[model samples]
Target: MWRSLWRSIDRFSPQYFKYILNELRGIKVVERSNRELVIDILQSMVEIVTYGDKHDPIIFEYFMEYQVMAEFVRVLKISKNSRIEAPLLQYLSIMIQNIESDHAIYYCFSNGYINSIITHPFKFEGGDLASYYMSFLRAVSSKLNRDTLCLLVKVELVS
Candidate 1:
């Protein structure tokens, strides 16, 4: 079953990648408050990355190639509730923390990707969401440098 699924995908195909991302974004718009449905979709995303070899890097590579991380951020930006945002944040944290390529990491900071997420976690007042947000920040800071950290502080984006 996995072989068949992988076979049908063109590893370099932008269409397949975009189709999955569009479907994810569509779920937010169409199903709005369906938390179970949202979690299900998020779970499927995690499953995709976990279903293959333990060291398999195909999914993350695809994500960077298509710049799908931006799409994920877009979803998180518009997310209105913890129910939906929590899983997305968890997924984002994984994506942000394990970024293995310099180019991908560069794009993250260069494209204002870090800014979007760095500020997201503070928007909510709930503890469940804040903890994940804090974790995400911790993951990001581990990779942050002096200049980037200074810039963030200079802009008053972080305390």
Candidate 2:
């Protein structure tokens, strides 16, 4: 359904991004079968945001306004297995790397959202989860600049 709509339109609209975000947030239960659906939606959102960052700022703005990253964190926390968590981290890496605006980078790193994901307890005994985690860190590091570095790391004042 979403693939058809995406191909039908020349460019994805903000409304479509909103609808996908709603679907992302509407996941009440995460069964084995539905994990694929969630991954698909996340993949679609990654594409949407990537396209938006290049072509349409409004789409990306809507994505940011809808707090999609926070939703991703929610899904990550609920999904205990590595199968689901791995792709979420991969898509998150892509999104973070594609984000060009400083404000968006700040939003991504703020609220301990990324921090929470960073601190998430994933069972990485032997799988690609560890690799994906490293890639996600690389993506975040790729975006680091003088302005955005402070958001990811805290430099507290000792009184």
Candidate 3:
């Protein structure tokens, strides 16, 4: 199910992609009043953030500027009421905090090739992509304190 959704996203036209983003943005804004919808939106956002775009300089620049983080924060605030069932809020919080740290920028550059796959998976010939992303996360993890790491996982399991 998830794979199909991702594949559809992969094939989306730029206008369609923008439309999806805009709709998600609106849903994110009203998420506080709609827990179930928020959960779906967050899951979609995670897919996009994790697998949607990694190579485009524009996406990289947008991430660097933290606009994505800001939008995530908006969703976090709305979803706080559903925190018991929403571990993503915690994951996102940690991501925002760590983005300011050196590890994020380092990983960003070092993982450029993998990032490229995320942005344009159609271009990926073949590789252990899971390990690549995992290693990138591990590299980021090494830079964080144990407490923060625990908090991130706890967020994942909370709901």
TM-scores, all candidates, are 0.62, 0.87, 0.41
Residue ranges of candidate 3 with Cα displaced over 4 Å: 1-17, 28-33, 52-58, 62-66, 90-141, 144-159
* Candidate 1 wrongly placed segments (more than 4 Å): 1-18, 28-32, 43-62, 121-123, 146-159
lDDT of 2 by residue, 1-159 (tens): 778876664437787788888888888766686889999889988898888888888987887788888888888877745278889889999888887876677878887788888999888988778999999999988987887777768899999
Select the stronger candidate by TM-score from 2 and 3: 2
Candidate 1 clash pair list = none
**lDDT string, candidate 1, 81-116, tens digits:** 545676777876775576655544555565667677
How does each model score on lDDT?
0.60, 0.83, 0.44
lDDT of 1 at 50: 37
Where in model 2 is the C-alpha error above 4 Å? 1-11
Ranking by TM-score: 2, 1, 3
Q: TM-score of model 3 relative to the true fold?
A: 0.41
